[model samples]
Target: MGNEQSKEKEKHVFSTHELVFNQLNEAPVYCFDQNVSSEGLAFSHSNLKVRFPSRQDQFQVAYLNAYLQLGHVDQTLSVRARLEDSVGSIAVIGFGESNTRSHSDLYLFDVTQRKVYLCGDEVPNVRLPVCGDGDIIQFQVDIGRGRLSYQIINSASSKQESATAGDRSLVTFKFDSADLPHSVRPLFGMRSTSVTEPSFHVLEVSRELSLTDKALFDKESIYGPVTLSNDCLNISRQDIKSNCCALIDKVLREGTHRWKIRILKDVGASTCLGIAKHPFYVPNMYGMSSQHMYLHSQLMVWRSYGGSLYSSGSKLSHELRPLDYDDKPVTVEFLLDLTAGTLEIIREGVSLGIAFKGIKPPVQPVVVFYAGCEKEVQLVSFHSNAPSGNNDDPILLKQSGSKRSSDRVTKKHKKRISYAFDRSMTYGSLLISPDGMTVERRQSHIGNAYCLINQTCSTGVYNWSFKINEDQGASICLGITTEPVEVTNDAIYESKSMYLYRSYMGKLYYNGRELRKEFEEFWMPGTIVELILDLVNGVLQILVNGINQGVCFGNLEAKAYRPIVCFYAAMPKSITLLKFEHFPSEPKAMFVPNNLNQGMPFQSNGLSEDIEKGIQRTDRCMVCSAIDGNVVILPCKHAVYCAAHAVVGEYCIVCERRIESIVNVF
Candidate 1:
């Protein structure tokens, strides 16, 4: 029985099919000798027996996933993922082998260099953050593309915990893999003389990686009290005394591009929209820094060069200034034509031609918020007109100049959604109307008032419209709370049971922590506020005055959630629930993929952005090409198979991995 249990444990050990470290009693050494454990491979003055894949499997696409353990980590430590021929490769087993023949097409993460190197060449455009102990490193060899890419993530960052594909925090580099031999092997070499030498623990042998869309804001570049929504395209902040800044993840090196920013509120001069070069200080949160230019609402152009602010910033012509409208929210467009060495500002499709001239390339669009400003902004549209093969191809403006259209789900279902304030859950100060549509806070109540909706949202998409009689300054905290919630003032941020959008600060709070994601629209008087709870995909979004505010929170718990509202002051004005709409189906499930062929590559026609936003699970099955995909592939967690196709293959067609199990959702 003991021997049988040991054999079961060995079955789960991650390794190539050609090598089983636990079965061998003697270690194989070609150079620096190191014994291999079933747990991982440690590189030091020790010998490890690791075998490369056989010649038949050499061209197959595989992913090498591992956790890099840093030892005595500092500027002197280094690690390399080298590609070498399987036959008679001396550098594969040698430590710090300087011979060029053994290190063909190698990628190195060196602490001393402060840069990632691809085959001894410095990787372009990718920034290398500081690496610490227990960081994750993944190497991908794409046989179809004939390319090799390496990605590394710092363990200390919150991004390491995310399973989302195409995470921008990962430092990645890709190069041609054509030079690799038929029996190529990915070997690891490290500087390990100390007691705590870095090691690589094998997690998986093979997997496919998803592509990235460089359209959203870079979460890593954000600083201060700013909150980003709409997949980081919308930026907002609370009324605060300090400034904050954020930028798009893509760098505008060289190309003709155009993007639009819609001001959701009248920010006046408190917010500045502009562009800045690389290596700018973000703590100051200044839009007009060295090599930067910004537009203020007061018809002033803030300009800086060579780390110096312009002496006469307001001297720019008034015609070049952005046009102001009486409407509450205004849309502003920026046309950056690097080919013409100019930047143009457009308002309402009117050209404020050539706001700045003789400008160079390699700058990022930035938004800065000053002290004591309550503002909300969204990147409504972006386009690129650059030709192919440009330095900014990924971010180039589309030549046709088309904008991203809203794909908001609006279809109605057979079941209608209806809910009202739960009188049983209402606080003492709050009064429910006879019709149960309006709730008023009595003037006699002093501390707080609370109310909950009658229905519990467990599945499907739901939208509830709300309206306030007046903008009673900073009086409401409203959002969703988990089940078994009590009527208490401290319940807002206390037990991680609720996610609230505080009208007092225009910010979001959850579990005693202030999230960087804020509500992009203000809660004004007499305007319709729609709270969209998509239980199908586990996301919460807001729409003000019929305009969507993108997703405020994602990956919400699958537990029963109740809508809640709280008033902090005694106000006679009543808050009313206008309407409720429910669609008892997933957004992706309604529309099936055109051609669901088995083993066919999934083509993303810009719908990948939606797929990444919790819509990766599809309803179309590959085998029968039906829309009844309910079975989810285990381990990969991909729900692309229908009931019939679920048991058809031993491997998942999407990720090309062995199916460990299958479970039907819903």
Candidate 2:
């Protein structure tokens, strides 16, 4: 029984004749050292061992480079492998025009300076600590266009502790196999001073990778071609002009079917790769938001620069910014599921977690490449994993943690926020536009309120700005506070208030005392007033027309705070609230105050700004007390708005006291 098992370990003969492994023994599956014998190479402990390690220069006795017998075609391939805990380098042992190892190509943990090389370039020295603990190394190869691309990843980190597709790995990145053969062989080599022969080594070869497209591009074509071939549909880099780069016809079924488009390229440079339900056409990443999905009457999800995924224009996963991708071979995949109304992203076989959910149905892959870009984005393949459009049918999906778009966005600003208006928190006479980008005070009364969906995380600058569209003096107090505000009340800066405010005079008032002053006079209309909470300096800086006003108020602690805007304007005018912005752009938009001061001012501004009986309230609505209170806001608890004026801007008209965060709520 032991002898027969040893024979089985000697080799694995497959029916497809595409792969052949020598199991854990000696000899090469494809190539063997001229001086090495079958008995010279042995598997001891859990590592490969040569008969003699001191004889490093003596042929087969000291070194052995064994190649797998399995042969792969010049297309896309996925070969899953597991590496035992060893500091010594083991080359997958194949190179263009040669199959050998050099000291420079030793895969290192600290990525090398010459990390990325094209065809005829040296092998990459990769070092991944994740692989130090016997992790799954998803070794993938793509052989096409007379070149080979290699990719490796740690299934552990990528899966987020989820059962890996197989095991674990150390490093991950995709690159072309330059100067390699069209029909290539696999290799497993062992070389190192710390190599141990303990445990066991295993290779789990899954299904072979094949192109789903009917045809591939003709490499011999000298001129650019866009026409289809008899067995293969053809589209070249030249055919991609403007944003109309590539479009596959595999549309998915609504509520059931999900579709994915795979492109072997980098995802950045203003290009957008996504799935749309209709015949979509967009100019750029920004245009993709309003352009295609509207015409198709469905949802759209795409991947942009540095691996930043997006649904429409809003970002999905900012965690993997501009993915740690170089100009190597990458399988940029965009997955859209109608069953869950979600979209996911996968790069080089590494799962990037679920991107977006609540995406409406009917989707197809739409790739747009801008002209004059050097990035080669080829629509190499596509497929659908969904069943027919069955609302009752359930599909088995294993996805990483992703955010839900359908969840009440009031709690989350990064997903979607400025939808016509702050569904809640606007008071009487407040008119927000249809897109909620503009807010207007229709009534001359003194009780308009506005607040933004500011999810405070901490650190960095928290800011938002608005252009004085109409006139000034809604009292227009811009401040940061912890207490929830009401539009019926005045600009409360003191008396039990742990917040600060600044009127047109640019004076930071905390508890009725001027804590910090920026300007001596009131600000002019049409000037952009940027309210900035500099958490690092522990102060709030107000900027007018890009001019920094030093520090407004300091002593903000590390806690949740809101950006508030209250106004009982002197005139019935308007102000356009722009998207929430911050200095030194960061993907993480939370503002967690860390400098809580025990002596932070809490005194109120004393006198309230509410309308008295003597001040004649005119032009305001009778129900909500607004001149043109339009659109009923949905989210805030103290919601009060009429069904007439346009709902626009970020600040809540009623619950509008403090700046919640400095993220792009609009």
Candidate 3:
């Protein structure tokens, strides 16, 4: 028995520290002028007048050298940590490096703000229980399972009240450990304002490097203003006036999915339950009127059209009666069939029938709350059947009783439209694969080359995605342009008529100007970029690695536009088309090839010689016969048009070329 006990002791380990100031190593101590007390286990700013250090307004950190072997087993650290505010500066206590520290490597708890942060970004929806000035806090690490959690008790408001309440209140926050650094040490940080300095204290510290059942919850699965249960199935919100949505991280693409939601806090008038495309970032509830489908608690069913881009195509059908919220816990059943494209709602064992139909795949379930609607809902049960693919059939979608059924669902049962690089339209240096799905530039190519998609888009939502097979230090550009726009060596980057997303700077550009600034460069080998062209809403959204980066452009015109890819590289590189999906729309191409005038004569005058020599173009409106011409037509590069005539003309009068776009020469 004694030998077995010795072996058990070797498997389990524990450590404790009194947090004495003198026993702690304070490296580069000049970062702050401080006073310390070993008996009290406290560190604070000194009252002595001295030269202010550069770290005055910033966080100064100190941690222990005794690193824990987190990978071996689960570990828990318990301590009494507290922050005393002096003019709103912050004090932090958590896990990180002691000697050299930054926000990126620190998993810290801000006592002043009452929030937990990992890599400088807040762990969304993790609640921290309210605590008094001083309370016991705990940090648990399960490195083998990639989970980290924080917990604190809700102490009473006063010392007298605390004795009676007995410390029952508790809240916990769980975070993904993938973003955490491998090594960690117990750490504390403090920041001081010029007027007053905040203080941080670790009254006691103890760790048990052994297994524990304290943390096994999936707490990080939801986002927004909501509280979740330990199982992460129940979500609740209260007292928030602004519109917010609790979006689940899971995407149900092609399957028959079913989930039961029990109303814990009766469904309010402002509550809506629905499914939306992933990365739904419409700021206001009104803006959410598009691109998503939902069932309002007020007996209404909303649907996203399979044809149009915006919510104007969204149909809302009124139910005969509203749900009876008087029932303490109303359980509502939601069934979605992607194979047949339908959604049915059932309440209290009664089927409400197919509430919605024609829903596309690749959507996520969401719950929207508005105007301080206090509500609590629990996902009691969830199930998804086999994958399905007939959701896009026009004949099946027309059964939704759509008023514009003929306009919305026109195409018959046909193969999904796929696009590839047009081999005949590519530059000399670029080589296209036999199937046209992949394109590669020759190793000898040292300059830029371009290629256009075989198909063009006009007035519907289209999704095009591609993968960078090999980058080879190349600068890639992906965007759309008019059909007539010339694809010169540098036209993709410099053309005023094209909208481009440049990979080199990770920014959007248009008309030779930067559209938006992005910090992270996203173009590299194996990176997949997806673009959504919503023509009806005039918006273009880009997604990288299955994450939507929001709208890149919001002013697209109703003209023929072809997807263009161009790159400049010193060595050969390859790109492959991965997926393509387009919604049906009326065909409208502004550029007509047969309308070009190859030999148009210019007016004989002193400027005629200069025009022929490419010195200057004409300054007369060929359309309305106006001399104050200031508009330049695209493709043929004719400048003989006034501003008013250019805006309304269908084609350039000089070259008789279809006018894709016009530039005002102000």
Candidate 4:
């Protein structure tokens, strides 16, 4: 138990302090300084003022020093000090350039012995232009290996230059007096030929390393093996000084274990690589090259849920046996090429899946490598095929089901009728009974000879109204009639009765007055006359009673057209039949008759009496002027009729016929 506890404790490891530096001071410490003139340059030592005195005085001047690892410093480097006067005078004292005549000479001194080594050295110098009254000069020193160089710049010109020794080597500088001018101040700077050491620390307790930190460190440095051990773990450094050979033997014997490895690189520094361990079911037996190596084990695996294996690949040619034929272990080998965006599966030296031509492979392979019941497995090796140059394509995974359906229906509706006439008629009377039945009438003759009520009339009636004789030119009377009228000429002419005669020779008359003279045939056979009964902006136009004759133009009066209910006819020489046809009913297109004078007059079948009751029931009696009293019912209950009314059954809305019966209602 104690050993186990110790082992657990040993899981953490610490590193030695490879290098150390003094706090130096929150305020910057004077490192080095130099003075320069046109004749030569000189180096000087710094005097550090201490806040608290030790054994001597509160102020002390010590040689500034730094400790570095072995081989850290090389030739061409040395340590030195520099000083500048208030008037822009400058000097340098150090381990190099101490000749008074040489422009590269420096003041030399030995601080431990308190002896002056070299003084008033003149080296190649650069003088800066003077500045304001109290302008201070600036100086800097470069140290490395066993050599040093010093320089200074004035406030005015602010230019700088370096000096060298006669032997082209380093020299030490010292001063006999320790006193400095009241107006002169020492300024220092340092430069080295050695590479700069990183200021980062590995063992900062405040900053604990996480998995991501470990991964990033492993990705950056090549000297350290990010380690986990019973005794010590160092992120960037490992020391095996005590048991180096023993540790090496142990590592060699145990080899590497197969585990997931995550390597993170600085986004601006390097590329990243990730590798995961294979399970026991998938065998990982692929060989490795120098650039690429297996992660750990020699086999990969994918465990099966029901001991059933499904094969997947770009194209499957044959079934592959498990790596462990006895089902003891199941695994498969797959190759991933980041640059080409491809993944290939190899089984038994045969290529089973090559999914590289397109995008990246899915998160996991379509087929599991080792699939039986194993919980853990191993991977032998892994390496990059290339630098992942630019695999622009993304991985695609297959789905299992179909997509959803849209919502709108897409069909059409059927049509009903065909060609239809769209025009208007003139001088024609349209009759609409109370029950929605409609009829049209036109007068074809004078003296009530021919009345085309609904497409039916006698020939003599049509002739007396429409045809006039050339010789003697019989006079004609015109009267408009919507109902069938009895034709009688020169026989039993009663008062207020319509008649046509030739008494005026060439004039037609209705009541002994000439209706039309020299008769241009106002009512001629096949003549179509249209009367504008009413017009309202040409929209609500009534050609006769219930007929809407659409829009019209031209003068109706000049055309011998009048709104009065009248007809046209000539004296008897020949009579032509006038026919009238009613427009079709509801949902049917309206028809405008062409020749009003040629329409046949309407005739009742003498069954008007029987149908009258049915017409009255439908309430389509139009001849009577009764507002509402005892109403007569039709057989169809659609029309009504009364006595003393000319019951035109053909024009009756009820029963869709003319009202022909006189029925008394209780």
Model 4, 580-626: lDDT tens digits are 11112211111111111111222233434444332323122232212
Quote each prediction's TM-score. Answer: 0.30, 0.26, 0.31, 0.15
507-537: candidate 3 lDDT, tens digit per residue: 6776666643452355667666767776755
Which run of 10 residues does model 1 get worst, by summed lDDT?
68-77
Top-scoring candidate (lDDT): 3
lDDT per residue for candidate 2 within 1-666, as digits (tens), equals: 999965773453223223323323111122223222323454432222222232222222122222211122234433434444433433232222223344333222221121433343444564323333344444434444333323334333432256442323333455544434323333344443443431213343322333332323322111111233322333433323223334554444553433333344443444555665432321111112112222122224443455555554345445454444455555666666676777777776667777666766544455544443334444455454545432211111111112222121212222222222363656456665433456767555554456444344256555566666555553565666665543324444442343444455555556545442245232455556656666654556554543334334544566666665555544565666654643333222232112222222222223123311112111222222313222223332112233342144443332333323221100
Off by more than 4 A, model 4: 1-150, 155-337, 342-666
Residue 491 in model 2: lDDT? 44
lDDT of 1 by residue, 245-268 (tens): 677654566778888888785344
- Cα deviation at 435, candidate 2, in Å, is 1.7
Q: Is candidate 1 or candidate 4 better by lDDT?
A: 1
Query: RMSD in angstroms, candidate 1?
Result: 28.5
**What's the lDDT for all of these models?**
0.49, 0.40, 0.52, 0.23
Worst 10 residues of 2 by lDDT: 392-401
